[model samples]
Target: MIDSDLPLLNLRDICKSYGSTPVLNGVSLALNGGQTLALTGESGSGKSTLLHLAAGLDQPSDGSVHLDGEDIGRLDDAGRAQIRRDRIGLIFQQFNLVPSLNVAANVALQAQMANRFDAAFTAEISDRLGLSDLGARYPEQLSGGQQQRVAIARALAPRPELILADEPTGNLDEETGDIVLTLLLELVAETGAALMMVTHSPRLAQRLSREVHLSRGQLAVQ
Candidate 1:
């Protein structure tokens, strides 16, 4: 039986390797609903690798990853894909958007894919992200900040319980980054979703509820 109160995302004794080269070794962490956690580390410390494992984008060599109390490692690729489409939201530094789609279509893409599209919620999020007037514009016509906002709207449009973000504000200038980070946190709180963000800035890490540092592929003390 699964516990309803279990952490939304859980990792136990996770390890990853490339051939014989170990990346993460015996790493464990948990993230509960509505909580925010920051993953921080130097380059090659496996921060992004850990995030990838959490998102089911990659598998670990050893250990278990549970999302909403279900063992993600046990799922097939299609199952994992479904989980991503229905339960998890992802934000990336590169602002992955479809160049051919206008802002409205891009924001609604994930929700439509899951067959859980909510028109009211989509409209609300569009306004909240300040994308209401850009509905007809394609990705190439938007500023970097606007593109990232569209990504944010797309992620949240599904109302996912867990959001995994990889250096979401890394490409922005400090001022824009601050604004976007603040908006991300606010939206996460509003939706009561747990956020696990991979960031290189200690200053940004402090804004999250908890910070986990990876040192030599191992989690340092909280």
Candidate 2:
């Protein structure tokens, strides 16, 4: 049974396909606030696809996705965009920051778009992510780890209810990746936000509260 005490993130019989190719087939899972769920799978196993669906970045062919009791799958495009803008935070391995913008602007960009920019909170997040001294630096000036940190800071600055991370440490070396993962989890815990991270590393998955394996688009408890 799903726990009611925790904030809810529910996916029911989710299905996705690209033409005749099925990526996620009847997958289902639930994540709660202050909880970290690791999604692991081999290449092409649909881990990233599931994360995208959960974040409302893409729609499932059939199924329902609910966040905090609201069914996101049923929302219109504009509605989905609003949810993404206001309540959902996404981090990617690519560190999709605007190169022209310095760290502070990049971190505050999303919050500003959502009209939720709080200078004090942004500053706090920057410090927590160890990005205070780099605020004036551009993405190009930072190293891989630092770039990822900026991405993390950007995602957390809005204080979203949920954070969806797709291979957040995929680009880093083992040591750097571990450090970045540590900070990600620490920040998530401090904010009391739910995190769903898609990764292929068993070590990383083990660090989470729960590990889920995705094979041929189906979720299996690990």
Candidate 3:
């Protein structure tokens, strides 16, 4: 069970550097359950790097990240992978769906890995995203907007505690992006999950509950 007293996701004094070039320096933040936070910055401001660290795809040079009140830095690669599979949902600009899998299979993939697969749930999300009719289509067969919705559905199918999105709408047109963002906001709200989205658009950032700007490897409230 999650500890009620702890924030859903917390990062303290996070610092990451590749040899002599520092990407993040002393960055700290916390996200509570059901809260939506927007991360905005110019390119190369370490936004994606921060997301990667939080998602356990990378590690910090210093400090700790706690998810479900457990310190992830202490865990080995396999242990961290377990936490990620069971607790986090990731959506990326690239819409990383498997080419061989059909839509339905793609949405069910993560939940299957986490041992939480439910056909009903996957179908429900796909329907909500207007992808029920496209269940048999491959990722390559879909348009940009359709592909993004599919990514969102796949990330959200498992009902994770946190959602990490890195430029989730970067590849879409404005109208399509708006539709996708609206769906993401509404669905994530219904699931009561925390969202930390990285975007370059201040307009989109304003739509979230809170916004933070990352500049020069540091974060400042905006």
Q: Which model scores highest in lDDT?
A: 1
Clashing pairs in 1: none
The candidate 2 region of ten consecutive residues with least summed lDDT is 1-10
TM-score of 2: 0.88
TM-score-superior candidate, 2 or 3: 3
Reference-based lDDT, residue 125, model 3: 80
Q: Name the lDDT value of residue 44 in candidate 2.
A: 93
Q: Give the per-residue lDDT of model 1 (tens digit) for 35-132.
A: 89999988999988898899898999999999978999999999999999998899977787999999999999999998879999999878876789
In order, candidate lDDTs are 0.88, 0.85, 0.87
The parts of candidate 3 lying over 4 Å away from their true place are none
Candidate that would win on TM-score: 3
Candidate 3 C-alpha lDDT tens digits along 14-97 = 999999999999999999887898999888999999999999889999988999788898899999988878889899777889
Tell me how far the alpha carbon of residue 58 in candidate 2 is from the true structure, in angstroms, after superposition.
Answer: 0.7
User: Candidate 1: lDDT of 176?
Assistant: 66
State TM-scores per candidate: 0.91, 0.88, 0.92
